[model samples]
Target chain A: MSEFLGLYPYWVVIFLMMTGFYIVISRGNLIKKVIGLNIFQSSVFLLYISIGKVSGATAPITAEGFEVYGNPLPSVLILTAIVVGVATTSVALALVVRIREAYNTIEEDEIKDEIRTQGAGP
Target chain B: MTPSTDLLTALILTLLVGTAVAVVRMRGLFPALMLMGIFSLLGASWMLVLDAPDVAFTEAAVGAGVSTILGLTALALTARRAKTSSRKPWPALVIVTITGAALVYGMSDAPGVGDPAAPASKYPVPSYVERTDHDIHIPNVVTAVLASYRGFDTLGETVVIFTAGIAVLALIGGVAVSVRNTGPAGGRAGDGQGGDQPDELARGVEPAA
Candidate 1:
């Protein structure tokens, strides 16, 4: 059990990714889908972080006579992922606002019906 | 094989599985969103367990923080319940099941757990440990991998961010112009004085239940 314990990170990541994917694909609400997408993205962040781990490593800072420093690469990559996530959220929010104004309803089915009616020409 | 590590791993795995199930099984958007947030936090912790502080920090900030806010805001503005029925979802179930099976099968070929001689750890870890002075001066091998070997990927990522900002600015500009030009303030000829039937149709008529 102890030996298996070390694999917890990998298992957690897989679970989160699948869960997020399920939500994004199965959910009808745009907002819920976005939430799921965030979850999916976060799981990948976990995977990278796990890969960057060195056993018994301290933080990557130069201290006197310090030899065992943890990896900094995953953190840097995560920073980039964070920025991308923020940008995506902002754009998604803007799109939602536009959707609300254009369709007057955020329900996907309702929007589709409205579009269909418009396309049918009364 | 430490007891503390085993306990922590079990706890984290339980949380991860619970959140993942809740994310898919819960009907309420808010609950699912909240669960998803929990999942992100668990993922961050998992990263920390893996010694990836940077990834954990990003997951904390972006996944658990900004994304949750955005998701909540979007949910507030949108419909709460999805219109679709929460039933079997047979096709998805079948596909996911098959994929899971394949993944499990592939794992059999994977190296034994914690094999220090594994390809990943054998070369890079040793090289990184011994030759931190050359190739990359950075102490962190992960940083070296991202900024050096996969530098192009990092560059592409930066470009993608720039593109997103540009896209948002463009969207804002378009929206602003459409608002100004379509309204009475713009002085455009025949700008919405009639308030046509479509406009009336758009004015908050409750959909049939």
Candidate 2:
């Protein structure tokens, strides 16, 4: 029972990951895909945070009488990662905007259909 | 404290899972974005419970705050409701199931959650704390580690953010100016991001002149 309960965090992370993965592949909407990618990245962040937990510890700060602190390294790395994820999201959204300008639709299928009907020519 | 933290983590994780599922299942792109923000907030709560307050703060701000704003701005430009694509779900489901199962199975040998004795918390562990104290003297070890021990890494992250900003500005700055101000494709002009019902995929700001 401890086994099941203990790693529930990991299970949640995996579930979130798969949900995002499914959305990315199954959904043809480009915006949905970006959101899926967002979920996937956030799950990775959770995984890193989960791995850093120390029993009975406080946040990774040196506080009086607090002997243990969560690992600082993962938190730091994830901080950078979170920022990078934002950057990626913005760039992706910008690209999506550009795509809308190119093709009248953001639906992947419609965009493909537009390409097929339009033909791959200048 | 351990019990309460465990309960809190479990509760938040459950909510996070629900929100993520809702995000994908939600056909309305805007609500899905909000759900994604909720997911980030829930993740932040879990992070706080797990004792990574710095990461929690970043997640709450960057994940929930900035990401949502960006998603909103993007939604403003794109269709609101996601069209039901013709793609078969069975294959994706099978792939995701296999991958998830494999990861969970692989995790069996890994240390249990919050296991302080785990290799991750053990390695050069005290070194960071000790050095941050001696060299940096900052109470917030995360800040010290990020700005000092991992100075180059943070610098790289800044470069990445700067490049992304430039790319976005280059790509979108003109778009804001050039996109024909067609003004509200369908739904009520007051309703942004699908606050009302819609049968057709939102025809957002068309760039066609």
Candidate 3:
């Protein structure tokens, strides 16, 4: 039905958000968790861009024939977000590397076990 | 929306969702990382469809480009395959379902996609479209708004990125990482193992502050 189709974008965004959230919570792999974070961050970007859409409008470059343009504010905000997401991901990966050097494993449970054993030391 | 645009958006969204699920289930870290990059590309495409070329350009460069490279580099330094998790998925699955249902239901009040009457279209008095020409005289309104109107936010982002670079350098860039295991008289048993890290990562630069 047209009604259902009208909300398809919302449904998809939610599905992506939940999937990413689930991966972050349930998965033990640190790298996977980072990937999940990226997914989750991306869904937020999509939501912003989705809201900025204006039907039948061209890209926000002013031209002679075009009468309307999609919201540039959202595009601008999402641009900052995309850059920040990359920065966050790289920092996370760097931490994962350091964690691997120290703990010798990226698995959450294994890292916990390492901490426990190390805690017993002097 | 035209039929072609609708079709493109639908197709890209389907691919994006499918890729996200694949990343969740995949045990091999490499393939999962690849899928994540693909998801970014697909999302960028959809941004294009939504008439956000500026956003799509940035996402394609930073999201699909830099993130993938950094992920691959980190993958090289760490474990390649993920160990099977010992935890049950039931709790996560239940939480995701409940939250998703609530979010979907709540969206009923949101303006339909691309509705011209949406608040976003009207507000921000002296809209950028009108001001870009009269005031800034820029052909690309997105740039005018992002650079001139919102210059401070962009400047702040630059600072944040600079800070992130310093963090990366401290964590893995130089001698700070290797120095932890430098002297034989270093900390107890577990510390010595770091000395044998890969040749490229091995460096004798001064210890990080």
Clashing pairs in 1: A73-B142, A73-B143, A75-B54
Model 2, span A1-122: residue lDDT tens? 68776687788898999999999989999999999999999999999988988887878778779888778888988999999999999999999988887786789998888788889622
Q: What is the DockQ of each candidate?
A: 0.37, 0.81, 0.76
lDDT of 1 by residue, B2-104 (tens): 4786578678878788877777777677787787778778877876676666677777777778777877755654445555654457766666567655654
Ranked by TM-score, the better of candidates 1 and 2 is 2
In what order do the candidates fall by DockQ, top score first? Answer: 2, 3, 1
Better of 1 and 3 by DockQ: 3
Candidate 3 lDDT by residue in tens digits, A1-122: 67767978988998999999999999999999999999999999999899999999898898888888888889989888888878888899999988877776789998888778788412
Task: Summarize candidate 2's per-residue lDDT along B1-209 as a digit string, tens digits.
Answer: 46777678778877887898788789888899989888898888888888888888889998999999999989878667788888888999999999999988888777888898999999877788877778997889999988988899999999999999999999878778654443334344436656554422243432221
What value does the lDDT take at residue B113 in candidate 3? 92
**Residue-wise C-alpha lDDT for candidate 1, range A1-122, written one tens digit per residue:** 55444454565566667777777666666766666777777767766665555555565543457666555655666767777877787687667656765776666666777888897412
Best by TM-score: 2
> How closely does chain A match the true chain A in each prediction, as TM-score?
0.87, 0.93, 0.93
For all the candidates, what are their Cα RMSDs to the real structure? 6.4, 4.9, 5.9
Clashing pairs in 3: none
Give the 10-residue window scoring lowest on summed lDDT in candidate 1 chain B. B200-209
User: What's the chain B TM-score of candidate 2?
Assistant: 0.85
Global lDDT of each candidate? 0.64, 0.84, 0.84
